[model samples]
Target: MAWGLAEFDAERRGKKEGYSAGLSDGISQGIQQGISQGAQQKAIETAKNMLTFGDSIEKISQVTGLSEEEIKSLIK
Candidate 1:
C-alpha cells in the first residue's frame, strides 16, 4: 500500500486536533470543580466563625445556606 503526503498529513492533523480538544475540555471541567470546592470551603469557614461569635443557628443557616443540622455540628 502507498500513501500520499497529503493523506498522511491530514491524518496526523486530525489526531492532534482531537487531542487538543479533549485536553481543553478536561482542563475546563477541572477548573469548574476547583471553583465549586473553594466556594464550599469558604462557606464552611464562615459558618465556623459565625458559630464562634455566638450567631444563632437559624441566622447562620440563613446567611450561609447551610442546614440547621450542619450548623449544629459546627458548634460541637
Candidate 2:
C-alpha cells in the first residue's frame, strides 16, 4: 500500500511539472508578441507625427529611424 501511494505521488508531481513548463512557455510567448505589436504601433505613430511636423519622407525616415520604403508605405 505504501509503495502504491509513492507511485501515485510521483505521477502527480510529474504532471504538475509539465503543467508549469507549459504555462511558462505560454506566458513568455505572449509577452514577446505583445512587445512586438507595441513596437510596430509606436513606429506607425512616430511616422504620423513626423509627417505632421512638416518633415519630408527622407527626413521622417531619418528622424524615426525607419527605412525610406517603410515611410513611403506609411504615407499611402
Candidate 3:
C-alpha cells in the first residue's frame, strides 16, 4: 500500500518524520554541549592548579586557552 506524502505528513500534525528526528537532534546537541562544558571546566581547574605552582598568567592562558581576566579571577 503506497501512502501519499501529504497523508504521511498530515498524520502526525504535519511532521514528515514525526518527533523522533527532532528529539534525536536535540539529544545530540545536548551531549555535545555537555562535553564542551566539561572540557572548559577541566581547563579552568587546571589553570587554578597551575596558579598554585606560581605559573605566569601568560603561560596559564596559553595552556588553558582562558583569558587573562579569567586567570586573574582565580587568584583569590
**TM-score of every candidate:** 0.82, 0.74, 0.79
lDDT of each: 0.91, 0.87, 0.92
Clashing pairs in 2: none
Q: Which candidate achieves the best TM-score against the true structure?
A: 1
Task: Encode model 2's per-residue lDDT on 27-65: one tens digit a residue.
Answer: 999999999889878887999988878789987777777
Q: Write the per-residue lDDT of candidate 1 for residues 1-76, one digit (tens) a residue.
A: 7999999999999999999999999999999999999988888899999988988989998998889998888777
Q: Candidate 1: misplaced stretches above 4 Å?
A: none
- RMSD values for the candidates in order, in angstroms, are 1.7, 2.9, 4.5
lDDT of 2 at 25: 100
Which prediction has more favorable lDDT, 1 or 2? 1
Candidate 2's C-alpha runs over 4 A off are 1-3
| Candidate 3 TM-score, true structure as reference | 0.79
Between the candidate structures 2 and 3, which one is better when assessed by TM-score?
Answer: 3
Rank ordering of all candidates by lDDT, starting from the highest: 3, 1, 2
lDDT of 3 at 11: 87
Clash statistics: count for each candidate:
0, 0, 0
